[model samples]
Target: MTACKNEQLFNPDIRLATLDDLTALVALEELAFNYDRLSRRSFRRAIMSDGSVLLIAVGAQGLLGYALLHLRQGTRLARLYSLAVASFARGFGIGIRLLKACEQKAINTGKTLLRLEVSALNQVAITLYQKMDYREFGYYHAYYEDQSDAIRMQKPLRHMSVEQSSHPLPWLAQRTPFTCGPVSLQMVLSAFNPNYQATPEDELDIWREATTIFMTAGHGGCHPMGLALAAQKRGLSAKVWLSQEGPLFVDSVRDQLKKAVIERVHYSFMKQCKTEDIPVHYSVMPLAQLITAFDSGALAIILISTFRMDGKKSPHWVVMSGYDEHCILVHDPDFEEKDPNQSPLDCQYMPIARDEFEKMSRFGQRRLQATVVLRAN
Candidate 1:
């Protein structure tokens, strides 16, 4: 599938569907699906429902994709009602983007379970959903009137309850500047509040005892858990940085990575770099600190991405490692976001040697960029 022009999917534009969007939405839907699909009138009613949500994706070129969410208020269950992408923009990851937007909406509304039904015949979509960790619950025989079987899938968001659960948000205690290689890095961790510290005996070890932690880097979700568990097996402390994404999204990811060897660390920031108070043991410096720390210590790096980054453009994650006469060393988690030809595997962490660093720096310096950090909170 060919994605639309760059300007069509690169813009940070998303909002709830309004009556004003009916004309454009109806047209797109009619063109993308068969007539048996819900009529415009039905679409209008769903949009107006209190427990339902409709999200529209738009770029400079206009409508790209739309997602409909059916949420059962008061209960923690949600469903992907429908999703459609503009015919011209099939390959640009619009479906996943719409799905993510719907997931975020469901989480924001306090839903803990997100489910969906996909046509069994659609192998492409089935593969994408499976790769995203949507488990098949069952199948409805010939559920579609057109003689198509339906695959029922579900994703649970247990960790999303962290905010509502008795558990509190993790906080930073103190940062001690340490050297990894030729660079200076600091370790960050959660600290007890002054009033809450009933006993001065509570030490870094107490806060470092993160029963659960989330990581949101490009590759963090896919691999760090293994390293973290290995380190924990050796009796080492580990923490992860989580992005403020949907609970279902985050929890689904955790389910895939959780192992007996490691425990989770609470860094307490969705946008890790933006948070000024970096957690103890958690370093904000990316590649520079990682290369240094990994060389001397076991600092595990997690790379994450919804898609591959385009080398022709600036990346989402950029870190300064060490500059030498020949080249620079860096680790880029957002490389997938920059690559236009991104796939599920591209979300993993990528290491750039000294030679490649100079090439990217020169490319990034010439590009204008901005980041819209979505906080799950």
Candidate 2:
């Protein structure tokens, strides 16, 4: 029950969890959830681990609630792994207080954004998160042990709302799972070329040009070089920037044949960039630099890992449609939307903190960073 020292305490009663509170935390967690409950061992590890911020809310009786925030390595994002309040003590503002405390702890640890997943059926928790300005960014099907779906959400710690620096861009949903790159390029092209009309056929055609589907395993994710080539074919100029040089996504494939095919596609796309206004550069661009490029009347399509947005770990493509001091607005092409009411809004003007983007921009073992800047010829 000791108070955290030195740091600005968000709440006097909310303090970092210690091993002594493990027994009480387990009891409170049991009363709060029926499935997906954290074990005593997990609680002990989280309390002792430097990679997480485990906070507990205390009242006169005992431990009233607890929150576990897991920080991702080499990233500025933290996952709200679990949060639970005692049933009898729920009427008080303990839940919100504890939630805010978790956010403050995350901010103290240099995390710019926080994300979590809640059961879609839990409207109470969802409403609370919404009231706190956490936006629904993604969804997971049959995610719970009880067969309940999960709603993925995120919030920027520093800025909860999009500022005046944010700009609106045309939104287009990817018709297929692996065509985000083409769809993102289409979104960018629409901003520069008024004649450009995005269609399912055109989307697929763009994907074919942007992907190395010869692997035959299934749909191959699109790469920046292919995206640049597709934009060139559409009479748009492009400059592709990469964090690393050798063929991207090679680490994603283990089969020698698959690797060779991907490498061949990579070299082929690289060779094609030799002509036209498309040029490739091997360098990591900072978030500010990217914002500057987008502000220069150029549209930038960037690569990101969906791990922070959803629970998936696949490379995703999104267009940087807007940028401001607090966050960068992205037009994500991939979406799992069942609500027509919330459709399109879920994918447009989605604000992400610059630090979060820094982590999300790189994907996989090599931490591949790719940005395709587009302009009208």
Candidate 3:
């Protein structure tokens, strides 16, 4: 076991994720975001998948934070999918430590660039990236349903070696999977940092201008809260078509809505896309029935929980956006979620996958599941 350099050592014990790590990872997700909004199944898949690069930070209690990287070999850039540090330890340098670990992995694999997107309003991340020599490229408007802009940033690994950073990374002698225990709910929920990209007022503005929007009230609790914020922004009426399970504990869903309409279903599916707020004036069907839905979308979902990084269950929220065949997206919103103040012109998006499009239909999960035609003006 090659040890990290003395300067690089925060003494953070690190390792790859394995089957046994699923419970811990899930707990971490729950802590990092509202559990009402995360998918445990996705965590399981990510920990066990070939494409996933999962790294953990071990300290006094257990795990302090984790970094998940998605590698696309064809491109030299490794996407920093998600990174989360327990709330108690923020500013203690845990995030920078884990980030170094990821950069080392990228360099070891011969990757040249690391690309990541943060909420345009995330000054902390932006400052960190800038300090790390990451350059800003562009912004995606309404990249998120909450209608926040995504600030894309990149760091060139060619010029910066893993050793060049103040922190040193340990070498893995023989790559082995890690295992841990389930995290506590207290640890999961208490670790959130609500530094959303835009101000509450900005969120209200985007919501007001939106004529069409999407929701995932059940999968991740963010949708419902997002809907409420959207409604407040636009002064437009908002509605939620949830599965029969009732409301999420994410935000105050009980009365946040002018109308908390329920859209019951036969089974509880992940990321089901049902509309709300629009009227059912059509002879054909309602608007809630026509939009496309899925178990997960390409955008990030938050997870909240309480468990130490090493113990494997801590309070925190995470953000997840992309997934593959067996897994859905999951992530930590350690900071506020992606920004929600971009223009509708920036809202255009195609399905991340065409196959998933068909699969989502088979599962009855589309954003516009039902098409309703109103009386012509």
Candidate 4:
């Protein structure tokens, strides 16, 4: 299904995939592949996820093909997760149209490279990729569910040479989805003290100590003051800065009892901080002030909404590894890339634009901003 004849360049209208296109895209997924298919659930998430780009091609006959791209946040590379055309529509130029659109979108979004892996058995697709200027870079053994190999190919989205940037911190991926708070803590601690080894057990322990069980979606996530207290108990001096007082993530919970429990936890955390003399500032830390604090030799564990990354309206934590005038460098513990060749460094000290960071730093209708600042005693 990869090869297309140059039969008079069939053009199709392309647009971003939406919820309305879900059923069509799902049917198209079924029509396209036998193994390693994207499910209906995956399509829904990608449609809503901020980290993904899903595009659909529409011709006079309807959805001819679609392409899904994974936008690597903080990196210049974008991965073509999937591309499919209707079985009857394969020989037309639909795949070419979808792929070129992907390249243009990648370039528009600051990605300099578009990478994909095609089954080595499918020389047609590999030929299409090559015709589009994609070069073979690597290969994966048994990369497919059917134990078939894949040939990795990539094409520069832009024609210019751009240098890559790396973060200044040792990187570690969060073992569980809910452990980003602790994983960020673990990374910052590794920077603070080299001999301090991080473990999965410790990650769960810190999560248990800090989680508020606020959201009913899957699991309760860590609280700001709770995270600060957990780290403080571990001997690092800690302070909690918040946008508003009382409780955090109260808006995320629906049941009355759960909200009350969150409030109770917040009160207890405040009282405990008072008793322990740990500083809890009842104000949002301005960017300038945060820069000053960072310059004073402190690492920050900050809360941001996943809406900007995964299109999910929930809280996620990342370490503020460093910052410059234009971009804020961070170590996001939640690494979602599944490609084996992609390294953990992909998410380490990733550069997010300053203005975009400011927008992503807040969550929910109240725009809650919170951070746990850690320092040497």
Candidate 5:
């Protein structure tokens, strides 16, 4: 495969990988990694998948190195899934050329950010990434097949500019560990109704109305149905999207009595929603649908996992204010130790890449997805 003529900024030796390069890619993967090596089947899929691009560095001696880039669907975020340089070509600048080419391809495909995960112990790669202007954001525990941790890194690219929203954001800090859901609901309620008082008293009261019996530990968390009911009781129209039919977070509880209590509470919420004629869907809602609902003057409170933001696997709630082509703007209610140096403008509207938002919008091993949409009556 020859390099695309328009993308000839680098040496003509670099080109896109095709099915003919699958054997070479697998061989290179074997030479570069001991355990998490990509198999021939995986290489074949990458070469053919529309969502990914595989580029290779070639020379007179054949394949020198390769880089795999993944463009997430419905997002401006690209991920460098794998990068490897053959042992014989390590001293040469083939790795750097491959990396630069990958970045160019990402930009050409309308990506504003490129992210990748590297093993925590890979000092050489980490140094190279740092030199390339990639910054560490977070980490994943035991992410590799060998049980090694991985450090997540991201690099921003220059692209089309997105205008920030002029609409005022409602930002409120959670009063307790288990009150993020209620706080987020308060923020949404206030956004819809200027006179809606979002005080700590209302936050706790909403928690009392929506709290589940048990979460991973400590105090209980809010249920999607309970949150919808809470909003409805406050003179708002609420709709819920929950993927599971039974009680959520039940797997986190060990005792049978506690599990039964949680189940009963969930049933009560379901019965109430039905009696009140609130819409409930027993499946995950599409991102496009959610965005459409938001554009139609509805406010959203979504549950997400905090692992990407704070390295914890707890359920969290966030208020979705607006969206553009590049990112989804949110107002997070958990402002415990927000960077003091950050300005009010920064705290008001936090921008998260669309793909990252999707990954964070689920919790637990089962990947439970829940969201509640509300609008003033």
Candidate 6:
């Protein structure tokens, strides 16, 4: 393989991988991981794919280590798909250099955050990631081919300047499985009125006030209009954005009675919105518009498909707080589990790409898009 011109200042041999290095990459993968190793074909594709960046460290002898970063389509998040160093090269600081190179590549591509999953048992890598400011946000059970658990970690790359700020919104974990909407609303409301106490009681109150009776499963999700009305009830000015102007979530229910209940609840919300003279837009609100609203001090509660974050195809709500050219930051009120080590802040100020935000800002087979913008009157 030809020497890369942009060599590392310290090593003078680290650079982007080319297709010519596929054989070495395969060898390195085999050496580094006995299980969950990338196949030769996968390494070849990664080397050639525009959606990925593979950085390799070389020596006079040949390949020493490599880091592979995968850019998620339509998202500002980049995943460090793999990182490995030859067993002989372990103590030479090659891993850190490869990681830094991957982070730089991600930032150059306008990515704001770098995330990865490492086996929980990999203490050395975990310590290195922590030292580099990567924080564990969550974990995946049996993530590996060998049924090993992996810890999800993330580090912010851009939007770190003091000028880049998130709204002073407090994150509240949903007390119940179906209270994400209410909890998100509570967080935004608390941002407006610091005296507003966001409690589990209030969460259920809001849910009762707003739920559509049935989602894709038990205990219906909140309708955007219902959420808007709930915010209004709490003395906040609200606007509702809907992609379609009909009963929401009705299509997800198979039982006629359940469908009718959902439709009735949705129409009831529409009537309340009308009676209160709330502005309901029957079109998709552009991300730019939502950003503008956020910039103007409006708190946004948005409905999104959880499929991107987790593999679940369910609708969920998150409170949008800030935005930049690279990402839209929000406080997600739902945590999959309660861990003493994981703080609510871990879920707050989470950066999501504008494009991915748009794709995720909808749910279900009908692809329903909805948002509730609120501000203190």
Residue 70 CA displacement from its true place in model 3, Å: 0.7
lDDT of 5 at 163: 48
Error in Å for residue 202 of model 5: 1.1
Stronger candidate by TM-score (2 vs 6) = 6
- Name the TM-score of candidate 6: 0.64
For residue 225, model 4's alpha carbon misses the true position, in angstroms, by 0.7
Q: What is the C-alpha lDDT of each candidate?
A: 0.45, 0.79, 0.41, 0.80, 0.81, 0.82
Instruction: Tell me the spans in candidate 3 whose CA falls farther than 4 Å from its real position.
Output: 1-9, 34-38, 159-377
Q: Specify the highest-lDDT model's number.
A: 6
Put the candidates in lDDT order, highest first.
6, 5, 4, 2, 1, 3
lDDT of 6 by residue, 1-377 (tens): 33332233237378888888989989888879989888877777777787788889997658889988887544566788889988866777888999999999999987778888899989999999999989986777888888989998888886643234567777789988899999999988888898999977899999999888786677888888989999999999999989997888877878899988888887888889999999999999888788788888898899998897767888899988777666688788877574322334347667777778888988887888898999899
* Inter-residue clash pairs, candidate 6: none
Q: Candidate 1 — which residues are off by over 4 angstroms? A: 1-4, 158-377
Best by TM-score: 6
lDDT of 5: 0.81
Clashing residue pair totals per candidate (backbone < 3 A) = 30, 0, 87, 2, 0, 0
Clashing pairs in 5: none
Q: Where does the lowest 10-residue lDDT sum fall in candidate 4?
A: 1-10
Better of 5 and 6 by TM-score: 6
Q: Each prediction's Cα RMSD?
A: 20.1, 8.8, 18.0, 7.7, 12.8, 8.6
Clashing pairs in 4: 2-125, 49-310
- Where model 6 places Cα greater than 4 Å from the true spot, the runs are 1-111, 114-165, 338-343
Per-candidate TM vs. native?
0.41, 0.59, 0.40, 0.62, 0.58, 0.64
Cα lDDT tens digits, model 5, 159-183, are 5344433335578888788898998
Per-residue accuracy of model 3 over 1-377 as CA lDDT, tens digit each? 22333223366688786667666666777787541223566556657765558888866566677888766422244777777776655676777878888999987875666777777766887787788878775677876546678887777675533221111111111011110000111111111212323233442343333211212232111233333223323333323333223323322233334123322211111123233334222122221232222221111112223222113332122222223332222222221123121122111111122233222212122122211111111
Instruction: Tell how far residue 164 is off in model 1, in angstroms.
Output: 21
